[model samples]
Target: MRLGRVTLALLAAGLLAGFGSALAVCLCGYGDGLFTTNTSITIDGVMADWATVLLDTDNSSCDGAAPGIPPQPDRDDPVQSTGRDLLQFTYTWNGTHVQTLTGRAASSTNIQRFIYYADSDNDGLMETGERVIVAGWKGSNRRVDLYLGHYVASNPGGDPMLDINGYSDGYDLPGTIPDLSSTGTPDYSGDWGAVDGVSMEWEVPWADAVGAPGLGLAPGSAFTFHVSSTNSNPGAASFPDQVDDNMGGCGGGAATTQYAQLDFFPDRNLAAAAGTTVYAAHRVTNLGNGADLFDLTAGAPTGSHSPGVAFFRDVDRSGTWSGGDVALTNTGGGTAIDTGTMAAGDTLYILIQYSVAGGATGTATIIATARSGFDVNRTNIVTDTVTITPLPRSSAPARWPRPFRPRASTTRFASKTRVAASWMPARSRSPTGCRPRRRSLSVISADRDQARWPS
Candidate 1:
């Protein structure tokens, strides 16, 4: 090789981790902080339990300088993972053994639980046995309730994406399982590789969810839902016999949360005396990829406040209303309430006249329900309190009155209103592009028909 010793060292340093894991390579500080802070991981789909993984390097029982290779031979060889699940970091041990590396392995115990939320009424969480009609959570018996694929490919690259069809390395485990040891089993090859993970991608549907706990019914206006995923050790899940009945995959799961809500008169705040329309608004977001079929019911604030037209927005931009957004059938009250859909990124705008709950500027609260189902995240419970103030009943001029206009002798059935005289062709003659135009006119006019004032 033309490269000198110094060049070789630099080259080794650059190629050490690039050919593989970005998480382990770039997040080296994170790896070092592992013991201080629990390692970070996330789960996309539903699975049985929490998943787990671990890392180690330089075990003396390991043969040669590295695992799975002959003592230094060919530069161009088949791209394969060394038998050991190790990270490539050039560090010296005990001030000796300087050129060695680190072994990085994930255990099956990384993930914990994937909580499916109820979507029927806006419940963001999932229950058991419910099938998805819409929204994020379907039910426990659903495939997402069972099989979840796992992979070692951490980033959202070509094959390893968050979607169900995502592929990692080549195969997928039901969930993230630990690596197989020295004997080189099927699930133990790639850093985060598995067998059962691949098949589940085709086996489940994560787009929509169901309500296992009598959820996804009707009549109720709003609800919330929640979702979670877990990981664990792979070695134990694959070869239980090898690790003395070891359970596999990451056991603790990482997660995220989001929601939707409604309000009567789902728009800007308006202050009306006793009988002014209050604009209401209902807003919905996917929170997840799943769509929601929401059954909503609303109770206008209980008070003497007058109620008029209900305000709502067309969330789907479909020029109509539908779905889990704020909607209702007025139960014979101050005002008739209407229903509509709150599509993804859509807002339902509603304007309804309401009587003041009390007298000056107070608040009114309304409750939303899915009629039959429950939202797990409690998102449906979002209430928007509106300010009700005394209506301005006194008639006032829309614009400021002119301060005593100079008298003019024109009798065009003139009323108390006075007009100030100006020039002919008026402001209309001003050439409007960038520069101001000057006009010549008479200061006073004796004739009504041909008179030009301020000429």
Candidate 2:
């Protein structure tokens, strides 16, 4: 049996107090597309580990009209300009930090800059949001500086530079890593890595990146943002067009292109045989943007028959076979399977072996549930049934016939029917009658000397 929505909510009220805000259960659509995951991603320059999360950016040149057209060519304007045509990128977020990888960096010969704007309130205007500018890059010492500030009619100089001689700010979060510090202390500003002369990467804690006096952004929170780059001559006064803008830039609709959705769903139910040896399988996937740690446990079975069972995993994504995947150790009764760690967008298969009892016949239903940070959806539980039937029995034997034996011939029976010969002959004619009358005597009287029948 499953609990109703109301009962689940009441129980969750107490169970979820320790955990952070719950994730909104929904599907993502549009923009570079929204992604959710439950795995911790490293912020190194190489983006091999970004398999779980998705990257959102624009590619159309500004030459044609909106919608089906390329962005307009670069002009002598900084506010409304299309910087580059092939500005490709990728990104992902753990609950605490956001990571971004750029396909094309600001051209070295020309003065190029990237502005990352975030509207935490989702009002479509930057008047009440945050913006981070990465500009003034030069060779050696990686002269790309990062600045954070609230937006208004003009540029609000990010007071204490976030990345200047290792001087970073403290945004008051638990176990936060530092990017840079001004007082020669440990604090995070923005950590970046060099991919190539034309590409770059950056990682920043959400609290510091969203530059507010006392503001913080948690997982499952929705917001609008724009990623734009400007192009200009080296040390020139005017900047040009910004192409590949995910959200329409400073002048257009500037609408929210993406909505952050968090969801964890198990594919379907499983079934297996009862008496015979068989396996039941289920796959659980992480559909959220941040890395999540999940706890897996089995609910009590519906039937009385207890099938001998064990769980296994496909660690290398190969088909589970001997010497390929490993068995998981049982953690008491009804508890998490294995270490219970699932990365975002990663799927883990649950292989359960059912060793049904000798005479047990019935449908045994087992419920497998996966619980992660704030993912209390009841649909996340998958139900599996093991049906067993009894084996057939043998029938009784037939009756026997009466005992009988025919008189045997001197040697062997040569005819189809056996004929018994008379011991003595009766009177037929006058001569034969007298001969037969001599007598029919007992074997003892006639054959006293020869021990034969009388004739």
Candidate 3:
């Protein structure tokens, strides 16, 4: 029967103190450093735990240079313009959807509204992967209308696949718009509610933000967004005066903008032996908007083979040796490391060095979890498995193949007792892709020639 090299290694008799039966062990090094939303959010316009408020000072005017062009008051104007700086808002998210609340002090039947432009890929450019959410409060109907933009695969940077007028409760309408409030007009009551100068609320699901079926955005997914308010009458005083002129009813860049950051564990896995120190590498990637810091933690299975696991930051991307790398202190109870800070799009490799306790053997598994700030979730947990087998002792000389490369061969034995082999450290290139480095190797038996460990 064909067996793996690791299994063949177990054929030897009498290993050091820690070998007897097959065992498994896990080393959890990914800590809890993810920023996650704990509670769900309601679509109502009220500001709750999942919401953040934005003040009038946050307004972005389309007519910043010539305030009189839009006939809106400038920031220096003590009189305080009526149109510009007329609304304050709040925002929140709950993994599945995003909610917003806006309010103004004046009462009007027709209020000029704005839309949100999203940089989903966070590359600082609005392209095919990006999205736009058009939302506004219709004082005339005392309701809010939300529209999601679908990008044309052929022209991602061009106008959305569907025009602004393509608003409906059906999926066929350009992009899939949430069935907000009823379908048609005149008393549309789905995902929005509003009262002139009082308050307005709106909610958009994660599917709408991604623009397609396969592009689902989960918790810890982040991006940058800018809100721009527009008006038909340029001279009409608006909530916030634009920094630039609203040429020919054209809108300028976003007025209010912010970078969003989120955290989630993407990859983790490993393999090791009992009583032997094995180096395992786990990676954490940032899939958020702004820069963020991740706090990592882990959980290990209970067994006789207590494992000693240490986490080291892989300063270089190689995932091999180190250069001024930081070693995290174990927080006991399974928590192995904390990565500290990681920028968006950056990946950090966690080098986990673990060894099983002596005289212990059986299957063991380790799980690691990560969290950033208040973000934490069980869905991002990563798991690793370890297998341990007792080393066998042999009395005679035998031919052994290199590690990871198993071959069937016959040999003769002269003695009945297992021969003790001395271990020596050496570095060389091997068929196995292990990096060239010094590692532990069992080389000789009583009356046989010494064998070299695979590099």
- Please state the error at residue 186 of candidate 3 in Å: 11
lDDT order of candidates, best first?
3, 2, 1
What ranking emerges by TM-score with the best candidate at the front? 3, 2, 1
Q: Any runs in candidate 3 off by more than 4 Å, and if so which?
A: 1-40, 45-86, 150-191, 194-196, 209-216, 233-347, 350-455
TM-score of each: 0.27, 0.34, 0.37
Pairwise lDDT winner, candidates 1 and 2:
2
Better of 1 and 3 by lDDT: 3
lDDT of 1 by residue, 314-350 (tens): 4454433456334445432323332333343333333
Per-residue accuracy of model 3 over 220-257 as CA lDDT, tens digit each:
45554444444432222332243111111012222212
Q: Give the alpha carbon lDDT tens digit for every residue of 24-69 in model 2.
A: 1111123333344445666543444433343222211111223332
Give me candidate 1's TM-score against the actual structure.
0.27
- Candidate 1's C-alpha lDDT? 0.28
Give the worst 10-residue stretch by lDDT in candidate 1: 245-254
Q: Rate the local accuracy (lDDT) of all candidates.
A: 0.28, 0.42, 0.43
Worst window of 10 by summed lDDT in candidate 2 = 168-177
Assess the local accuracy of residue 440 in candidate 3 as a C-alpha lDDT between 0 and 100: 43
